[model samples]
Structures are given as structure tokens and as C-alpha cells.
Target: MSAVTPLLAAEELSFAYGPGQPVLREVSLAVAPGESLGLVGESGAGKTSLLRLLLGLSAPTGGRVVFEGHALDRRSAATMRKFRQAVQPVYQDPFSSLDPRMTVGESIAEPLRSLRVTGDRAARAARVAELLTAVDLPADAATRYPDAFSGGQRQRIAIARALAPKPRLILADEPLSALDTSVRMHVIELFQRLAREQGIGMLLVSHDLTIVSALCGRMAVLESGRIVEEGPTGQLLTEPQHPYTRRLLASVPRLPG
Candidate 1:
């Protein structure tokens, strides 16, 4: 565990859709400042539900999420606003996450405008340009629509938007799942750079161990809506103690030599 306060944490968390259909149970995890924690699991394992709870998008039926030593209070406007400014999310589908009617610049600036981040119009526009450049997008990308770019480029734009707020933590839900194999590598590199150079913490949820391993130092495996195992990425992946963790590792695809 990190000595410093965690950026985000879920304590004894649980959730369900309808009666007798639980999605998560007693799940707990944390992302420390400048750290990356990968949550991995098979489909229907409740990874997304856990993520939603962590993000304060949905209230937990059992436990609570804590951010920066305070319990999340979605009902309090002040608390929610501060939380929104601190945590940014990168959804799996870049196409759907972005507005079709808005230009890329407008999309990136939306958080700044809505969050009331300190800046005049020109300052925000300059920040948008900086973010685009950081994400390896050209300045002209701001004027283009989402359809004007490839899937990889769109995800980069989404990343740029997420970084625009200078968030303390990033909640990424299968960010690379929607991209091609060739593109996933570059996107993963971008995430690593955020952790390494930018000093940002991330809660990256993915089913692929290899992808997460490339970026996260710690990892937790979810099975049947519960955390079955967790530890350093290399140790846990190489010597998985839980049967489910072992099974997940065995499922990863390898290249033909």
C-alpha cells in the first residue's frame, strides 16, 4: 500500500441491477497518486459496475467510494464538483463518448467550461491546443469532427479531453478494447507516459493482462463480481495464487512464431 493518501478507493463495495442479481460484492481497491492500478476480469465479472461505483456515477448498494480521504457525496453539489474536477474518465468507445455535433475543440473544452476551471476564452483555447499536441494530435484537429479521424486518433482525442482538466486520477474503462491490435500499443504507451512523466494516477480497467501489465505496477483480478487476487503486476501474473487468476492468464492470446 502507498504511504500517501489514495486518489480513489472503493471499500467493501457492492452493487446489483435487480433483486437477486448482484454484479459486485465486497470489492475493495485503491489507486494512489501517480500510480496505476489495473482491474482485470472476464466479461460479466462486474468490472464495469465496480468502475461506475468508483467514479461516483452510481451509488453502491453495500459500501462507499473515497477520494482524497473523503467519502464521495454525490448529493452535495460542492463535493461532486470537486470530485469531477479531480477525476476524469476515458470511456471505451471514443465515438460514443464524444459529441457528434461538437467540434473536437469544443468537446475538449466542455469539461473546462462545465467545471469552471480558471481560464478566459483565449487561455482555454491555448490549453486545448496544448492538450492536442500532448496527445500527438495536430492543432487543426480542434476544428474537425470525430468522423474525420481514425479510431486510434479519436481515442487520442478522447485522451486529450481527459487531460484537459489536469485531473489527479483517470478512470479508464477498457480504453484499448475498441482499437486495433496495432493501435493498442501506441495508446498503451500514452497511458504509461501519463504515469511516468505527467505524475497522474490511473485506474485502468481491462480484460487483457498483457496490455495492463505494460502500464500498471499493481493489478487486481475480479471474478464473478469479486476481487479474487491482487498484487504487483509481475508477481501476480507470473505466479497467480487464485485459480481464476491463473485461468485469466491462460486466456491471453500469444503471437505465432
Candidate 2:
């Protein structure tokens, strides 16, 4: 564990669809300030369920989600609002994540308006432009709608929107999965730069170990709702102790040396 206080943490988090249908079991993980952590698992391994719980979209059957030092209180609007501002989310599908009806500028600025950020229209506009630039999008692109851009560009716009609130942490759920292979590395580089230069932490959830290795310093392998192994990304890739983790590593394609 990092010596610095964790920005977000799940303590013994467990969830279930019904009395006997448990989706998660005693899951614990932490993302420290400016740290990038990855959660790796197969389909139906409860990764999305855990994310929903962390995002406060769903209440956990057991355990709790903690931010900074305080336990999350879904009942408290103030707490949730503050949490929302500090921790933003970048979901997998950029095509569906963005609103086709809204202009790109409006979409990016929505958080500032909804979060009640203390800024007038001009200030907000400037912030939006700044974010667009940060994500390598042209200032003029903001005038267009989501459909005007390609998949990669749309993902950049989604990233810009996530940055509008100046979040301390970003929860990325399979952020690169929907992109073409040609663009995946670009997005990965963008994520690396954002975390390095902006001091933003991240919790990246993906089934692809290759993507996880590229972006995360540490990783946890989930199997059947349990974290079977975890460690530094390099160590986990080179010397996975669990059978599930080894199998996962073996599944990754490698080119001839």
C-alpha cells in the first residue's frame, strides 16, 4: 500500500443480485493520489458490478466505498456531489457516452454547469477550450456534434468532458476497448500523459492484460468475484502466482522473438 492516503478505496466490498447470487466477494483495493491501478478479469467476473458500487450508482450488499478519509454516504447529497466533482468517469463506448444532440462544447461544459462550478459563461467557455486543447482536439471541434468526429476523436471528447470538473481521479472502464488498434496506443499515451502531468489518479478496469500493462503501475487479477493475485504490473506479468492469473497471461498473444 502507498504511504500517502488513498484517494479512493473499497473495503471488503461484496455484492449480489439476490440472496444466493453473489457477484462479488470481499473485494478490497485502493487507488492512491496520482496512482493508476488496474482491475483485470474475464466477462461476468463482477468488474462492472464493482464499478457501479464504487460510482454509487448501486448500493453494495456489504462493505463500503471510501473516498479520501470518509466513507461514502449515498444518502447525503452534499457528499455525493463533492465526490462526483472530485472523481470523474470515462466509460468504454465513446459513441454512446456522448450526447449526439448537444454540441461538443455544451457536452464538455455540462459538468461545470451541473456541478455548480463557480464560473460564468465566459470562464466556462475558456475552461472548455482549455480542456479540448488538453485532449488534443481543435478549438473549432467544440462547435460540432459528436457525430462529426471519428471513434478516436469522440473518445478524446469524452476525455475532455471528464476533465471539465478538474477531477482528482478518473475511473476508466475498458476505456480503450472500443477503439481501433491504430488508435488504442494514442489513447493509452493520452491517458499516461494525463496522469503524469495533471497529477490525477485512475482506476482502470479492463479484460485486456496488454492494455493494463501499458497504463497501470499495479494490477489485481479477479476470478469468480475474487482477487486471486495482485502486485506490481511487471511482477504480476512475469511471475503470476495464481493459476488463473497465469492462464490469463498465457492467453495474451506474443510475436516471435
Candidate 3:
């Protein structure tokens, strides 16, 4: 671990649906301020379960999630409100993540209102426009509904919404999985630029090693809800020590040279 305190961390975290059905066990990892960490695993590997735990959407059965050195206390509305402001989530499936009835601007400004950010209606509108530009969406697009946008555009809108709070950390769960292959790289670049320019920490959970390789400096390989391996992204990809990690890397499609 870095000497600097983590922006978010899962320590010996575990989860389950019932007595015999374990979803995750003994998982531990951290994302430092302005750093990006990737959690890669196959479906049913408990990746989403872990994300839920980190987001405080679900309580873990064992251990705890720490944010800036303090354990998360969901019952404390004041504390959780602060936590929500600092940490935001961008989920999978941009198609369903957004509300069809609300205009793009309203959706983006929702966080600002819900978080009680210090901004009036006009300020929020300006912030929304700024965010739309940051995400490469036209400012005028804000008046349109989700149905007017393509899958990639919707995802960009989702990203803008996540950024509205000026969050310190972003918990992105398979953020690019729903995009077209041709546009995936563009979104990947967008994520990289946002992380670099805004100094925001990210915990990206995905099944795609390629996406993780593109955005994450450090990565943790999760298998069956456990962290099988973790290290610098380059090192883990080139010299995977765990069989599961190696298998995952091997599965990535490569161009014949």
C-alpha cells in the first residue's frame, strides 16, 4: 500500500446471500487519491457484489470498507451524505441508468440538487453545461431526453452526471461494457482524460482486461469473489503469477504480428 491514505478501501470484505452461498470472501484493495485501480473478473465472480459493498448500497457480512481512513457508517446520514458527495458511481448499461423523462441537463444536475451542493438553479445550469462540454456533448443536448442519444452518447451523459458533484472518487462499474466496440476506445480515452485532468480517483470494475489495461495503473484480479492477484497494471499483464490472472490475460484478443 502507498504511504498516502487511500481514497477508498475494502479490507477483508466478505458477502453472501445465505448460509451456504458465499459471493465474496477476504477481499482487500485500495485506491489512493488521484489514482485509478481496476478490479477485473468474469461474470459471477462477485465483482458487482464488491462494488455494491464499496458504495454502501449493501452491508458486508464481514470486515469493512474504509474511506480516507474512516470506516463507512451508512446509518449516519450526515456521514453518508458526505461520503456520497465525495464518492460517486457510474454504472453499467447507460440505456437504463438514465431517466427517459428527464432532460439531459436535469439528469446531470440531479446530483448537485440531491447532494445539496452550494449552487442555485442558474449556477447548476452553468455547471451542467460545463460538464456536457467536458464530456464532449453539445451544450444544447441538455434539453433532449435520453431517447435522443445513442448508446455512446448516453454513456457520456452518464459520465457528465457522475462529474457534476466534483467527486473525489468515482466507483465505475463496467462503465464501457455497453458501448459499441468502435466507440469503446473513445470512451476509454475520455475516462483517462477525466482522471488525469480532474485528479479524481477511480475504482473501475470490469470483465475486460483490455479496458482495464488502458485506464488503470494498478489492478487487482478477482476470482470467485477473492483477490487472486494484484500489482502494477503492466507487471500483472506481462508476468501474471496467478493461474486465474494468466487465464484472464490469455483470453484478451490480440492482433497477430
Candidate 4:
């Protein structure tokens, strides 16, 4: 199956750290070619757990996870490597994601190096600089350290690093949650641009429904480990059918009358 196909799927997925302590309760979701789905919920509502399951990081305690229409088993050396190559994840904190000791340039280019991109060091550095520009950062950013950049700028660096692999799907966990409120909106917009322009399907796990509603075409609201409401973001937000979803929608701060 191709990455452009209904590339990733999870059916009735449930997981937990211990017996009788499920974190995800039969959470079913999918990401087809060029699609973005936002999963939103309060802390401990299994948002992060669900993201991990979708990315084939943790084995699903129940149900199955299918990538490129193939069910995953940890031991399949070839299949596991293929899955890893096709699916990449962007963490919430850029500073922590990068090795402080490594220069920003090195951090972004490491994936290519690991993949054995038979090129001279100069070629790799050029590629890294190109990616940095793609995320709206300066080429000089390649020489600087993550500590030298602001929170928003560091996230752009993280995004550049995530894009280095040219993966089909990116699982972003609260990617913009760490930035200041003023800078959060810009990062969210950058994600929207990447999803549409790159056709990079994203499983965005976040608690900010406002951001989800703005960037996502569809969203699932998790409550008590289950998806309480899901549909087109516009419809769900305006006319949520589930009580929990309604509560979530109502809780979003509204502008003054």
C-alpha cells in the first residue's frame, strides 16, 4: 500500500499501562492521504496515549493498528523500519527535542545522516539550511543553538527537523502548547500551511479546541478515554451533539458581546 492511500488506520483501539486501567477506550480513528485530524481532551483523557498507539509506538492493548493497510507486529524487522520511515512525530517542546550539545544545524540533518543519504557534508548542510528556510527561519539558524532562539523560533526549528524525513504523516503532541499565547497562533498557522501544502497528514493531540477548530477539518473530542463527539470541526463546535462535547465547546472563552 502506498503512503498516499488511506495510509494509516486504527480500529477499536484501547490501551493502558496496567490491567483494568485502560487509557484509551476503543478509540477508533484514521488518517488518509492529505488529511488532518485533531484529538482534543483534558489531561489524562488518553490523548497522548492515543497518539502513541496511532504512531505504532506502543502496542495496542486491544484492537489493531494498520499502517499502509498492513497490521503491525514489533518483531517484523523490515516492516517496522518501513513504518518508522513513513511516520514521524513532533514533540511539544522544541528545546527538549533537540540535543543541547548538538548545533541546530546538526539536529535537523541527523535524520538524513541516519538514513545514509550518501552525500558529502556540504550537501547535507545545504539541505538542512533549505529546510530551515521552509519553516520561515533564517539560514543562519543552522549555526545557532536551540537556546539562542525564542520559543516560537525553536518550534520552527523542530518543524524543520520533522520535515527532514519527508514522511507522510506527522503525529504532533501539543506542539504549540509551550509557546506564549501571542506566538501560539503563528505556530498553529504554520501547521495548517504544512498540512495543505505538503499534504502531510497530522494526528494533532491538543487540549486547545480553538486551535483545533481553526486548523482541523475534523476533530474528535475525548472524554473518559472514549471519543464522545467527532465530526467536521465546524459542525461539532457549533452544534455538538454529545453533552461532554457541548461542555467543551461552551468552555472555550468567547469574545465580549
In model 2, residue pairs whose N, Cα or C atoms come closer than 3 Å (at least 3 residues apart or on different chains), thus clashing, are: none
**Which run of 10 residues does model 3 get worst, by summed lDDT?**
1-10
- Model 2 off-target regions past 4 Å? none
lDDT of 2 by residue, 138-174 (tens): 9998799999999999999999999999999999999
lDDT of 1 at 143: 93
Model 3 root mean square deviation, Cα atoms: 1.3
The residue pairs in collision within model 3 are: none
* Clashes per candidate (backbone, < 3 Å): 0, 0, 0, 0
lDDT of each: 0.90, 0.92, 0.93, 0.84
Question: Please, what is the TM-score per model?
Answer: 0.97, 0.97, 0.97, 0.93
Instruction: Return the TM-score for candidate 2, rounded to 2 decimals.
Output: 0.97
Clashing residue pairs, backbone N/CA/C < 3 A, model 4: none
Which regions of candidate 4 deviate over 4 angstroms? 1-5, 117-120
Error of 2 at 234 (Å): 0.5
Model 3 TM-score (2 dp): 0.97
- Residue 89 lDDT in model 3? 95
Worst 10 residues of 1 by lDDT: 1-10
